[model samples]
Target: MRKTVRVAAIQAEPKWLRLSEGVEQVVELIGAAAASGARLVAFPETFLPGYPWWRWVDSNQWNVEYSTRCRENSMTRDGLEMRRITGAARDHGVHVVLGFGERQDRRIYMAQAVIDENGEIVSVRRKAGLNPIERKVFASGTPNLPAVRHGVIGRVGALSGQENQRPLLTRALRADEEQIHIAAWPGNPEGEAAGPDSAATVSRMYALEANAYVVAPCAVVGAAAWDRRGPQTGRGSGQARIYAAGGAEVVTPLAAGAEGILYADLEIGSAASDRREVELAARPRMRRGQQQAARTATPRRLGADRWAVPLMLGSGPGGLAAC
Candidate 1:
């Protein structure tokens, strides 16, 4: 039987620094997408309280007030905001992959939550690495979280912001049989002009590497958000896009500064046929004697702490605890 799924990439601005308002906006968007026949909807990175654009626009000390308010507005895994989002997903009968700032105690991480159609929280993944400016506000995450989960359409996974640029991490998700990958990115007014580090380039590369449908949900920084940052700051041009299993463009890139949902119907089962052409995971393995020899060799310390080892090793689905 042929399997097809309609997916949506949400490119909208959050109600800057207002958690309640942001959640309401997202809920309305989810309902709209569901009404339009979207089975899965992916939101932009840190759509809850919005991305830390101030971190880039000003110095750390200058952005302290914005940073503090952002943390105060950040949502916990099972917090009220999350409950509302999941509730919307359930009411609309649509799976949601939402990116938000996840707060634990006093620390916050760039995180994404995968919600099934029935309102169950299937998986929660944190960004394994943060960009330089992002490091000022978010903490690093471990690699042992369940990056992919079985959903109504197929296996879905997500990577936040710059994490889409991590080859090894994307490879691991591919090995876990991810059929659809969500590449959540913050707004970049430069768009494709931002060169190799641009979100557009990285997202397209991930689709080509994983041989899976890639849904790029990007945030838009509007005038209000710029006003909050400081005087005379500019807005971001949205760069939302969707790619098929064979790395073909499924939808034209959302225009810069546009705020709406981009939808596309994907052949979810076609990834199997694509994989057969170039199976990276099934190609070959090291000789048994060489593997044993390598195992016996002294392990090189990855970082100054024990947790760093696992972070560098990048474990598979079995290593993660049930969410």
Candidate 2:
């Protein structure tokens, strides 16, 4: 594996339910990242069709309206929209880790896809754990899916927002010997995850525990985008940041939200060395029974299998938490 590799994380407003437009925007970002010399590029969770900020809002009407549109705009794994993205990766000569709503049959899962520079759609992992409200919109997939794999830069992997908090999921990723892990999030407050200084703590720990560099890109909710004008920065919105193995802070292009790409040159040798020291031992700790228990208990935990995501109406947007 190469000792150094360049990566990029995108922090921008989503295309918002425009499937073809979303593909174009992704292609643009890929080209820009490749031009900037990034070997790997990552985006925030559900970035293509946009994050369901409405689900976090209390307005059932908006949630109902938006959820349907989001599903309709969601891309299928084998669809032309995805092919365009893969083609962009191939043309740009960069590995892409992207988050999108994956339409499969009648269900939509919060999904992440890893595409290699050769245009091969290598892995598509769905979100396995959903919070109560998230269950209202997206379907949970099988947990602890394979995330680590050989790619352009080296062994790479990706995960959606809350999955970073899931012990089993992260453990599985670590056991897989991931070198660069994309910690994708829809968007969260800066000072979160144990309430340190910034949300970096969440990813910092993830980097340390997984023995990998962390590329955490977050989504931004544009105030005008609510009305479909353009993406304007909001207060305390997310940043595109990266952390080195063992929690060393790297470059961050946008620290306080807006539109930009975060880039970092990582020394992957440390992660490779760490994995060599731990992967075997960690694999033994991952019990098949543990996954079985979670799967068996999921139905009760997520409530009756509602085919459509419910919009648990509340007082207002201010009443519910977005991200």
Candidate 3:
């Protein structure tokens, strides 16, 4: 990885259900970030066609026109929209980490596509965990899937929403030696359960624990979105920010709900200490892994969820529950 690298974390109002316009805005943002000399740019969760604001605003109305529009706007992994995004990355000579709703067959997933500086998609990871409402709307991503990718700049990985909250998921990325981690969120509205303060805390903690640079991009609901007629007040932690290994903010993050890009010139050397202060910090996890492995050694197959369950529940320390 380069000793000094510049990246752009984008926080902007999504075009909101307008896939074509969203792509245009993305291309424009790429050009703007490239002109500013950022080698990598990361966008918020489901940036294309915008996040499903109705999921929180009025989920009861999901079977309406908005839901259909959302599905219609979702881009396929290899669709024309993705091709255009790749082209933009190549044209600008910059890398892009995009979070968008991915449509496959008839299902949608919260997916992140990591495009390298050469415009090649190095990795496409879906949201690792989905809540009850999300489960109803989006398909769940495979658990324990590889998170990091070998990018032109460095080892880059991304997680959307609650994925950052999963200790095991974050631990897996750390083991992968992720150098750059993108934490994507659909802007934290103040009235929501997971508020802005908590979002910032998790992101900062991830940077510190993973010993990696974090590019957190969040999306805001502007006049163009479904929440426009609702209580779309400016109370949310909707800003792009970057953090170093020591949980230090690179730039004083953009103001909440602000539409802009946060750029950080990362000097990796500053954070690359011997890590001797906590020698067993990374290795202590081995024992816990051994215990879990022992429990799942029998590996009883669970249904569509594809979880491995151990039938020998009360049979010893090597047992796992199916439910």
Compare the candidates by lDDT and give the number of the best one: 1
Could you give candidate 2's per-residue lDDT for residues 1-323 as a string of tens digits? 45779989998878878878988999999999999999998988989798776665677887788788888999899999999999999998889999999998878999999889888989898887788877888898865445588755777878888778766567667766788889897775332344543446678888877767899988776663465532334545666679877787887457565678888888765657756866555543424554444334322123232222122123433222211
Residue 127 Cα positional deviation in candidate 3, in Å, after optimal superposition: 2.0
TM-score of model 3 (CA atoms) = 0.82
Ranking by lDDT: 1, 3, 2
Kindly report the root-mean-square deviation of model 2 from the true structure over all alpha carbons.
10.1
Q: Which stretches of candidate 3 lie over 4 Å from their true place?
A: 58-63, 191-197, 227-229, 235-237, 269-273, 276-323
Weakest 10 consecutive residues of candidate 3 by summed lDDT: 305-314
What's the TM-score of every candidate structure? 0.85, 0.80, 0.82
Off by over 4 Å in 1: 59-61, 189-194, 228-236, 277-301, 304-323
Relative to the true structure, candidate 3 has a C-alpha RMSD (angstroms) of 5.0
lDDT of 1 by residue, 1-323 (tens): 45879999998878988999999999999999999999999999989889877776656566887889989999999988899999999999999999899999989988888899999998887776677888888887765434678766988888887778765567668768788999988786443465787887788888887888899999887667755445443444657989886677998877777788999999877665657666656654555554445455443444432121122112332232211
Candidate 1 TM-score to native = 0.85
Q: Which scores higher on TM-score, 1 or 3?
A: 1
Candidate 1 worst ten-residue window by lDDT: 305-314
- Candidate 2, after superposition: displacement of residue 222 in Å? 1.5
